[model samples]
Structures are given as C-alpha cells and as structure tokens.
Target chain A: MKILITIQENNVAPRFDLTSEVLIADCRDRQIIGIPRTILMTRPSSEELCGLIIKENISRVVCGGIEESHLQYLVWKKIEVLDAIIGPYLESLEKAKEGTLKTGTILPGAKKIRSMK
Target chain B: MKPVSFATCNNFPVTEILNGVPHGVAILDRDLHVMEMNRFLEVLTGFANADARGVHADFILRSNIGNNEKLFRNVIETEEYLSISGDIISRHHKKIPVHFTVSPLKNESGDPAGLLVFIEDISALQCFDKKRHNMACLDKILGHSPKMQEMFELLPVLAHTDATVLITGETGTGKDMIAEAIHNASKRSRYPFIKVNCGALPESLLESELFGHVRGAFTGAVKDKPGLFRMAQDGTIFLTEIGDLPLTLQVKLLSVLDDMEFFPVGGGKKVRVNVRIIAATHRSLRVLVKKGEFREDLFYRLNVLRLHLPVLREREGDIRLLLDFFMREFSTGLHKSIKGYTPKALNILTAYAYPGNVRELRNIVEYAVNICQGAKIQKEGLPRYLFIPVEEKPPTSADERRDEYSEKAMPALDLPAEIGEKTVSGSWQDVEKEMIVEALKQTGGNRSRSAKILGWGRTTLWRKLNRHGLA
Candidate 1:
C-alpha cells in the first residue's frame, strides 16, 4: 500500500533527509524505498488537503503529528491519516509497507503500538 | 444524631468510627493533639482504644498517613478542607494508599478551635496510574514537556537557512543542547561542531587562541598553530560565554563578523576561513553593549538567529522528568538499584530552587547515588545546602568586594614603578631615559611611532628623552 508522508519542509532533503512518512510505517524495519514519495505541505486547510488527496491519490496519509483540523480533513477525504509515529522517516515508511503500523505514536510510547497492531 | 459534648465526642467518636464509618477519622484540639480518633482509625492502625487522647499527631501515627506537616498546617490555617494522597503503612506493615483531608474547627465565637483529619485509602487508582504513566521517555534531548514541543517545532524552521544563531540563558541551561539540535537538524549537520569557551582563558592568550599565530610571534611562541577558525572551516563555531570576550577582542571579533576574513595575530599573511559563528552568553549582552564593553555591531550580527533557554524553575513540570532521567543515568553509571525518593526528599526537592539548573540537578542525583543504600533516597541523602537554596557562590560581602576592586586597581596606578623597573638599580633620574631607548630599539628607533604608541604628550616625550640619558 502506498503511503503519503507529510514533510515539515522540503529543504531538509539530501544528507540526513530521510522520509518522515516511513516513520509512520513499521518501526521494526524502517525503510524509505527511495521511491518518489509525495512530500505534502503541512497542516493544509480542508479544501487544500482535499485537492492534494485527489492529486496524489494518496492511499494513506501519514505524518509526524497532525493537528485536529488537518486530521479531520484527511478523515473526511477518505484518506487514512496517521500521526505521532516517530524516528527517522525511513524507518516509519518501511513499517507502513509491512501494514503493521499503529497510528499517532508522537514518540514511541504515548499509545501502545504493539498492542494496537 | 444528638450533638454530643466536646469531652464525650473526643474519646468516643474516634473509637466509634473504627467500627461504624468506612472512612478514617482523627480529631485534634487547638494544638493538633490527638484528643480523639474513631474506630476506623483503630482498624487502620490495628490497635485497641486506650488513652490515645492528648498525644501529638506525629507520635500517635508516626509511620505514615500524612507525612507533610506543612500541608496539614495549611489546612488548619486556611480553615478549608485539604486533601492529599500518599502511602500509609499500618501497624501490621500493610501499605495502603491514603487520601487524607484536614478540616478545622471553629469556636462559639467563630474562631478556630481545632482541626479534624479524614483519611480514605486510594491504593488501587494510584497503582493503576503508576503502571499507565511509566513509559520510557521519548525525546530525551529535546525534553518531554509541551514547552519542548514548541521548541521542537522551531528547530526545523531555524534549520531552514544559514542564519547565525545567538543563544542566551543562565549557565547549564541547555543552550548548547539547542545549538546542537539546530546543527543536527540543519543543512550543516555533516560539518563539524566547533565550540569555544570565551571565559576559560585569559584575554591575551585567547586572541591568539582563536586566531592562529605564526612562529616567533611572542616570547613563548614556538611554532605556527591553527586557531579554531581554520579548524572549523565551513562548519559552525559556537562561541560559548561570548559576553566575557574582552573589549579589545570584541573589536577584532566585530571586524571578523563584518569582513568574514580575519588576519592571524602574528602572520603577516592574511588568512580567510569560511565559517558560521553561533554565539552564546549567560550574561546580559545587551547591557554589556550599552556599557560599551561588548561591540554593538557584533551583537546585531549574532542576533540574526535568537533562541532562549527556559530556566528549570520556570518549567516546574520538567523537574519530575529531569529528576527521573538523572536518577536513571546515575543508577546505570553507578550500577546501583535506587528505585525513587522518599516523601520527605521529594518534598524538599519540590520546595528547592535549583540555582545551578540542570547541571546542579545532575550533581545532586549522582551524589545521592553514591550514598543511597535502599531503593528510596531519603532527605538526609541530599546535600545539606539543598534544604536552603543559594548554596554555591554565597552572597558577596560588600566590604570584601571593595578590597578586591582596590587590589586590582593598585597595579594600573603604578606606571612610574613600571618605568623604573626598566632601569633596574640604575639612577632614578636615568630611568626615564632608559624606557625611551628600549622603546626605540624595540620599534626600530622610530620616535614618531613610539610617541603615538605611548600615551606621553609629544612635547613631554621629547623632554623626558632629553632629561634622561637618551639625548
């Protein structure tokens, strides 16, 4: 399943620039796959989010953390929204590929990932 | 329920509640003496009724129940109900989580006569909470408070560009941590993080220390050495304790910031090093600039990127967190098994104002680890001064500070004596002659430049040279 990772800023790519999307994936096997993952701007309004949802055909919308407005927007768009999964993004992305990701991790333990998965 | 007289209610109601009421009750007089306790108190204590009246609260129930005397007294003073939850061990050593409240009594004149304390065991709820909230700390470097979440959000935005950062806070307040976080999250993470403490070395040595000096530069100059600027080429140079940089050095630093190229102290050849300078200072640099001690231009240059560290006291929320973190760190490093702090120690810590901030907290934890024997650290295990803050660097004595200032002023006032030392056992009159000759020899005998270098009036300089042996 393809996952859409919300990046804070586009300028952070290159050296330590790992995808924050994979951070929402599976922490056990964090992989980036180097595929062109859509880096959506953060906390967009409902209409803006809806436009991006249709544009990217984003099956799952994952990010570091989502505010209530953005979370609601994604939920309405029928795009699965996950936030709070932490770590280098590549690791989270790999978890998403494996389909074992628990949502809203923030760090590692705010909510129980193992129990949820 | 006919109202019983004070004397009968005291001894009997205490014993009666042990059997009748589900809650624990203890009655105290104007002096907090246990005039009467209910049957529930007896069950809670596993004791039979006796002459338990007229005993002090601490003596009647010494092991546990409400250990915080001040909290208890507050209830009495406020004439309001006060509730708190803590561990309570019975006579049989059975631990019960007690939620206790104290309510005061008023006389017929509507004045306080005594205090009444009620206790309810809350072990189950408190235990469940402990298990739920015991997860490992996630953002150890950034901290775990909502305040830190705000800082974490700023880190990425600050890293988006190459703006020079100026971090300000009290010493040991994680200014360096924020600087490191910026670099780590910035485009410059791959480059080196070179740090220099401006206050560590004397200003004379520091000039050469920061800007490389060529061989034969001064009396002790042995070989050419690269300064931090050359070493940190293309990386971030964190100028820590920057407010301490001397006035002379501030000018050089200002020029360096403006031109982005600084000549080595001794090297006739100019050297250029490309580096981003991030400065940090605990002192009020703005005040220093106003006093003309720090360069104003340099202050503006470094102020391009500003980050302030919040003191630990302001974040009373983080104390419990930092305490736990330091405890774990000390436990692992010392290989000890300290579980936590006793009620008294935690109270003492909560009351304390940690003057040294996080560094002081770390030191306290390590000190406790060395002496702690059991799982819990008691109040006595902490350093004596912790009971009272401002332990380090006691208040400066006014008279003593005046003497210290005069002691430093004494040397600068001895200009005649310094000139006399140049003659060294020669006639006092000829001493003036000898200084000019030495100055001339040192400066290739250029009188024009020597007159400018020395603060002597030009006419006075010539008169002195003639008056002495240096005709």
Candidate 2:
C-alpha cells in the first residue's frame, strides 16, 4: 500500500538535511515503504488534495495541519485526514510511518486559505 | 554586541530561532507591557515597531502557546521558571507545536518584576509523545516467555500493519486478552474492539450475531439487531475459537473478510464495512480442515498472522505463582481461612500432570480448599486419586477373569471395599444434600467461590457438612 506523508514545504530536499522524504525506519513492520510525493506550498482545496491523493494512489495521508472544511471534505471523499502536530517536518514523517499521528485541529480557514488572514 | 534593536510591544522572539536566525524578538514588562520588541518581531507579527509598542503579548499572540498566562503567573509568583510544549496556529492558520519557557524578570535593581518568555516551535514533541503513548499501551500486556515475548515484540510491528491476525490457545489461556492487547496497541485502537465467540451459540444464532439480523427474520424477531461486523465498522473484531464455526458460517465469514461487506440476515440491503479481523482458535484448525470440519478457504484467510499460547503444563514454574495467586483468589470467596498448603501437598500438586491445564488446576485447588481443615492444606485434604499408586498387584488370573466377566462399569467391586459409604435421599433438602455430598467428593468439599462456580450457593454448599455426617 502506498502512503503519502505531507511535511512543511521547507522540509523538501536541500531545504532540510533529511536522508529521505518518506520515512522507512518503521516500514519493516508494515512491510511497506512510502513513496515521497510533494505538494506545492500554495493552499489547496480538499477536492484538489483528494485529486492529488488519487493521482498518487494514496491509501493513507499524513499532514501537520488540516482545516475543518477541508477535513470534512476529506471525510466526504473517504480520505483519512489527521492534523495537530509539533515537530520538524521529518519528525511528523517518522510518526506517520509508525502509524501514531493524532487528530489535528480544524484550521481557521477550510478549503480556501487566500482569505484566511 | 550586534544591533540590539527592540520593539516596544511583542512578548517573545524565541520562535525565530527555529528559522535560520532570530527572526523576531520581543520583551514584556511587569504589567505585561511590551518593554522592547525587535525588528524581527515587527515583521512576523505584522506590526511595525511603532504600532507594536505598548501592546500586550496576549492580544498579539493568539495561540495555545500564547495562552500560557497562568504558567507565566506561576513563574512570577514563585520566582521560579516553567516551560511547556504545546500547539500554536498562526494568524494564517499554519499550525505547529512550540516549546515555551518563562522566567521571572528582574529590574535594574535586580528586584523581581514581570517575566521574559521564549517560544520555540517544537511540534516534534507532539509526534514523539504520540509514539511514546503507543508504546505505553503495548507495555500493559502480560507474559514474559519467549513465545509470548516474541509475540509482544511482533505486536507493535504487526499493529502498524493492516493485516489479519490469528491467535491460537487453550480455553481460558487468555486468547481473548491477547486479541484485546493487539487491538489496543494498533493504529485502530481509537476504534472499537468487537468480539465474537464462535462456539458459544449455534449456527443460526452465530450468523445473526456476526452479520446482524433484520426485524422479523426469525422466531425471536422482535427488533432489528445490528451484527458485530457492522458494529465494528472501521475497527477490529476478534473471532474466538473459530474452528467451532460451522462450514456455512465459515464461508460467509470468509466472504466478508475478503470483500469487507455482507448482507444482514433477512435484510435486503448489503452493508459494506471497513474492519480488520483478528481470529483465535484453541483447536488445530489444520486438522479440522483436513477432517472437513473447517472450511479450508476461511482457515487460510484467518491464519495469516498466527499466535500460539503455550500450555500451562509446559510452564510449570508458573504453577507455583498461579497457585499462590489462586490461593488468595479462592480463599476470599470460599471464606475459608487457609494458612497455606503444606510442602507435601504442593509436591503432590506439582507432581500431578495437569491434562486440563490451568483452568483444571484452578478447579482442583478450589475443590481441595473446601475440605481443608486448618490454616494449612494438608495431604488428607486432597483427592484420594492423587496419592494412589497405579501399580497395585491385583488378585490372580482366576479373580481377574471373574472381574472381567462382570458387566458393570467398575464390576461393582465384588470384593469388600475399604472406605465407609452410604447413600442418602430426602426432601428438597435431601436433593440439595445429595448433590452437595457428590460435589464435595468431586471438589473435596471446598466451600468457596470454587464451590459456587460448581453451581451451589454457599449455604447449600455447607449443607453437605450436615448430610455427610461430618458436621
């Protein structure tokens, strides 16, 4: 099964000194290794994220922060969503690999962040 | 010193350290007035040094991290320091966890005043806490033997996987406990842990119990009953003693496990579920499959992640522990004040091979305690069979021939027997009396919960004392 983990945009490649974007540390138990897929920093709609999730053939999604409307949208889309995190981008990736991330909060703005100020 | 520029309004610029350099810095005074706010603070808070002047950190910082005014107060009141890690979503709704430390601030005279707060985004703490919490739940499970330990090690790894698990063990060997432990440790722990005992009820009942039933499906059709599978949607269900499941039900179970959906009994609508199956069996399902007692297809599906429980006899050292454990357990309920078991009795108990295992030993202990007189359980209190030697020389060939010719089960012991025996009967009291006497012989007159487990109320249990002429 392919699992997609979302970290802060700043964590991609040379921006952060991570050995790998997808955490393989705990993959032995899952008998699975994650495939790293990057989503640009611009705020995206839940439907848009769902499209991406489908494109990536994502069975599970892990991200640091998810807003309420988008969370509902993901719920409607039958896409699992989790928010609420404290850590560097890679830390969240490791936790996601271990299957221990918790329910994140509903972000102030739901699907749209342009007017979120 | 580097340009120590300050903004008069912001509270802490520590969050800037998480970035390339100190991007923001602010200082607060005794009345929580902004003493100094750096240029970095102005850019991040979206306030110029002039506009940010004299502003309180509370209004400027709107997040769980900024809400630690109480911890700040504690620092001021006790002249101590406090640090906490928590979540913070910025005005733009970019959520993250940060570490905050507050220390009592001193004036030019070194007198205590307000405080200096430092905030560093440490969302990593939340992730680490989560993993630690998961491990904590795993540690609650009992058992330390190699097999159990191996499974314990495997559980955390397995819990991460979305795989079907199979647990095998004897009755009351805590197979259900193992299933629960696994579920509790899994990613789906937040969801339900539904359980089904395949052997408890017959096929029709078991079917309805598993897949649910529509109202008016059968004779007891008073109301609609939701099946366990539906109840366990997006969760895990433990199917115990799966070998006892009828072949037809096995096929159905296999179908649902394969498809994640099933039709409710007598209901036209089909309910699709997202659930994991963790099955357990005491019987060798393989043997049953070969014997045509179990469905081969279903057996293979449920046997994926196999767990085996070792017999209690194999771990005899646990016997002494279990005995001491059950001793206190039975003593309280049986209301018998047993000081302890004699070494000789313990020897006899330890020497006997427990074919029935722990549960049987529990039954034996409960049975023996009732007949125990003093605080100590002596040899006389045990069943006579435990002490009898198997190799006794019987009468010659002619006598053995006559005994063999006898048709009764025990040949009625044509020769005189050693012990005194009498049969008694009477009123309801007599019936109770006879039953108690027999049970006492069965359990050795242990008038405790063990006796109650045998189905006699305590008072009726003691009636055996009077009837047996031992009172």
Candidate 3:
C-alpha cells in the first residue's frame, strides 16, 4: 500500500492547499518497506498535488486542514483520507503505520528545540 | 523583585480570572509545552483544554512561530514581551487571522518559569477593512456622485441578464470600464473576455478579425484563424467604438446577434457561439442611423439595454473628490509627502473644464505630483494652459467659462515658456512614448519608480515599454 503525507518542515502543514512538500511511503502488512520518498514541489497548488496523488497510485493520504472538495475528489477516486490531523509528521506517520491514525487527531508529545542561526 | 506565588495568594481564583478574560489565554512551561489553556483559548483553537494540555503548543496553535525552542529561549533570556499578527489553523481546518502577545513568566528568585500568551481574533476588523475598500472602488470605477451611484446600482441588475448591452459616452469617459465591470459581474466572467476595437482595424481585416477566416479565405490567410467571437465562447465580447463598424460588417453583426451564429470568411458552414455581446461607442448611433451611416435594424438590436456615462465635468461635486483621490494616490506612488493642494491651485483645478474627462485629470495629477516639491501642491506645479492671468479672478462657473473659450470670446492665452505641451512633440503615441522615456530617465531606469512618476501601475509600464521597444 502507498501513503502520502503533506508536510511543512517536520510537522504537518496547517493547510493542504498551501503545502509545497509531500512524503510518499510504501508499506506492506502495516510495516515500512523502505525509506520514505520526499518530494518538493516548485509551488503550492492543491490541484497539482491531487493529480500527483492519482499519478503516483497513492491509496491513502494524511494531511491537515483539507478542503471538502479535495476530500470528496480523493474519496471518489477510492483513496482513503485522514485529514485535520496536526503534529509532527514523524509521529503522525507512526500512527498511520499502526492503523491508529484518525481524522482531527491532535498528537501530544515533546517538541524539538533548536537554536536560531 | 520578589515573585509572589499565585497559589500562595489566598482568596484569589486565578483560573477563574484567566477564564473570564475576553481574549484567548494560554500558559506554557519552559519546554514550550502547553501547561494550561483557558476556555476562550480552547474555543478559539477548536481543541479542548484537556486534550491540548502537555502537548507542544506548535501542534495546538499552528502559527508562524518557527523553532519554538529558540523563540521561547529568546523570550526567557531577554525577559521582554513580543507581539505579532498572523493566522492560525483551527482543528476544523478553518484559518483565522489573529494577533498574539507573548510574555515571559517568572518564578521565585527571578528565574524564568513559563510563558503567558494572549490571542486576539482580528477577522472582524479585517472584514470591515475589506468592505470599506470595496465601497471606495467598485470594480475599479471610482465615483461618489448620485448619478454614478445610480449607475453602479444598475450594473449588477444588467449583469444578471443575458441581454445585449450598449454603452454610450464621450471619449475618455470610461465606457470600456463600464462594459468590463458588467462582464466581470456576470456569470460569464469565468470565461474569456475578448475586446475588439472597430476603429483600430481596417474594413476587410475588421470583418475577419470579428468572425475569423479559414485557410486561403483571403490572399494573406495562411491558416484557419478562430475569430474573436469564437474565442469568446461562453464569455463576453466587447465591441469598442462600434460606431466605426462599416455598413457591410453591420449586416453580419446583426445576423450573429439574432442567430448566435456566423460564417467564417469563405467558409461554407456557419459557426455557432455562445458569446454575450457588449457594444460601446462615443458617438450617437441613432444620429448615425439617420445619416445613413449606420443600419437602423442593427442599431435597434444592439440597443436592447443602453447605458449612458455622464462626462466628468457634469458629475457635480466629483471634481474635488477625484482630485483629492488622485493627489493622494500619486503622492503615495511617487513616495512624496504631499498633503493637499494650495487654495489657489485648487481653484484653478476646479475651475478648469476637463475636456478629456477622468483620464486627463489623472494625468494632470501625475504631472503635478512629479513637479511639486513642497507638502502642498502650489499653483506653479499645474499645467501652463490652466493658468489664467494673475490679475484676473478665477472663473466662478466652469460651464460659462468653457463656452466663452469655445466661442473664442476669451482673449488669446499667452503661451508661457514652460508650456507643458511644448515639452513633448508629435502625435498622441509619440507624446506618450516621450513621457515614458522621460519618466524612465528621471527615475534612473527604475521601472517601478518610473511607473509611479507616470501615474501607472508596473504592469502597464512594462507592457508599454515592450510596445515602444524600450524594454
């Protein structure tokens, strides 16, 4: 199975339409197959991303704050969507792997701290 | 300073006080973890306080706060407050504009304990600003006069229908702008809006340009060309200067209006289109019909819905308003600090009849803004032709003075050495090119600043620059 997650830096992007980076992971039997592929788009466009999902044969999508029209389109294409989920992408990915990821899930955990350049 | 513990302070319900505040309030520990949040914060963020507690605030309130560790550390070290305006995404995926105030919280021994953050929703204020901006300029047509106000009210009513529209006005009175505004307000706005100028092209080319031509239709026709009517399918086709359309093309136009179909030049088959027709002219089509210059049936068909734009000179109380508007716009665009016009300058501007209407007024303001060095626009900054003799009192009635000048009853105006027209030479295009070149020279080839100096937007300047081979 293939899954796509929209991300900004390390955390899930707040809006799907404004996300310019996406991670695609190929999994089998609810376990990881290899390292996830990170794709960086030249610009943020939900329509282009939707087309990318179909072209890549993605079966599942995890994102934050997706509009209803896009959600319906993905559903129409037989792709499962877990949206309105916020937190670090790593934790979200883990939950998705474990089959515990739910819509509108706000993951709670310690945050990464780093100094400014 | 000794830190007073809130728990030690008896008879005070700190949580209640925090919850009673109007703004969203949240308490975060030094690790940038959400320790507690009030009811308002929960409602604003669309997350329950219980669920948000202990989670990183970045996840709960997804804002532009990059690297929370560094930001919180800076606030802790500096012991200073920071306020910023940004947007946050709620749990329901709704983006809300908000202002945030973050302050450091201290414990005993003057050690940093946590942070206190306040969030204020600003969407209502933003909505009000947007409403005010739309009120000032409706579809880029600015006028506060009662007649213009009535026309503004009628535009939407006309746009809702698919009736053929005819816009009549003098040159430079913004007839094209009215047609565009109607098209923009209509459902067909989602499609293309193709504009064709009947006067700009010759007769044979004009017909082919409107209805297109097939391969080998004319001697120069090399390929099949989809005409403007076909290109504007499911949209609007604006015919400007319709009075200039020749009698031959008028019959073809009338048939298209009646049947929504037309045959390409030399094409046997008729091409059907679903385009809306919007025709504009500066001359009276009725008068043209009587003169045998225009077809009466076509004129009547095109005039199903008529809109006549009043000249700027006749729009009462609008001259001063437009002058002030242009003055401020040019001042800001030119990066000048001009506040207003001097009384003498204002008198001359208001008394002069704007023969070229609003477009001319805008140009004059741009010219004045470029020359005026002081905060107020002085009389010397105005065009030389607008200046009456210093000894003569300014005219009290613009119409009467305009008529006197038209009848040649007024004395021949003395040509000043600094006459504005003398600075440029040749036809209107030549003068415009000279002005653009001069503006570019004045701004040292800075396109943005040159555009401001010429009272035009950057894209307009860019297109003109390319057209004149200056780019």
Q: Using TM-score, give the best candidate's number.
A: 3
Q: Write model 2 residue lDDT over B1-471, tens digit each, in one string.
A: 111223221654533432334534455655554555555444444344454445445433334543345556667788888777664444333455556666786654666666766666555667787767756645544445565566777777767777898887665566777777777778788899999888899998899999999999999879999989989887899888787888889888888989888889999998899898999877778878888998888888887887777766566376676666677778878888887799757776766655455676787788778777679876556655443333333433322423432332121211112121221122345434554555667667566743554454677546656666655
lDDT of 3 by residue, B1-471 (tens): 122354233676565777889999988877777777889888888888777777767667766555555776678789998888888777665678899889998877678887888999899999887645533335568788898998999988888899999998766778888887787778787799899999999999998999999999989899999999999999999999998899999999999999999999999999999999999987778878998999999999999999999888788888899999999999999999999998767776776667567887898899999899889997657775554332334653333444554553432323333443443233446656877887888889999998876667999999999998999
DockQ (0 to 1) for model 3: 0.29
lDDT of 1 by residue, B1-471 (tens): 112244445466435544576777787666565666777776775433353454445433433332335555667788888766654544343556678777887666687777777877677788666533321121345366676667667767876677788988766678877776666555566688788999999988998989978898988889997888888887778899998898889888888887778888778887887788888987777878887878888889889988887766677478788888888889888888889998757765655556466877788888877777779886557765443211133433323333433353211111134322432334434534555676677679777766654446778778877777465
Q: Score residue A45 of candidate 1 by CA lDDT.
A: 43
Against the true structure, what is each candidate's TM-score? Answer: 0.43, 0.48, 0.61
lDDT of 1 by residue, A4-114 (tens): 555433211111112222212212233434445444345434345446666756667655423455556667877776554433344445556666666633223221211
Report the lDDT tens digits of candidate 3 across residue range A1-117. Answer: 898999877777767877899999998998989999999988888899999999999998999876667888999999999987867788988889888999988776323422112
DockQ each: 0.01, 0.02, 0.29
TM-score of 2: 0.48
Q: How much native contact recovery, as a fraction, does model 3 achieve?
A: 0.37
Error of 1 at B186 (Å): 2.4
Model 3, which residues run further than 4 Å from truth? Answer: A1-117, B1-57, B61-139, B387-471
Ranking by DockQ: 3, 2, 1
- Highest DockQ among the candidates is held by which one? 3
Worst 10-residue lDDT window, candidate 2 chain A:
A11-20
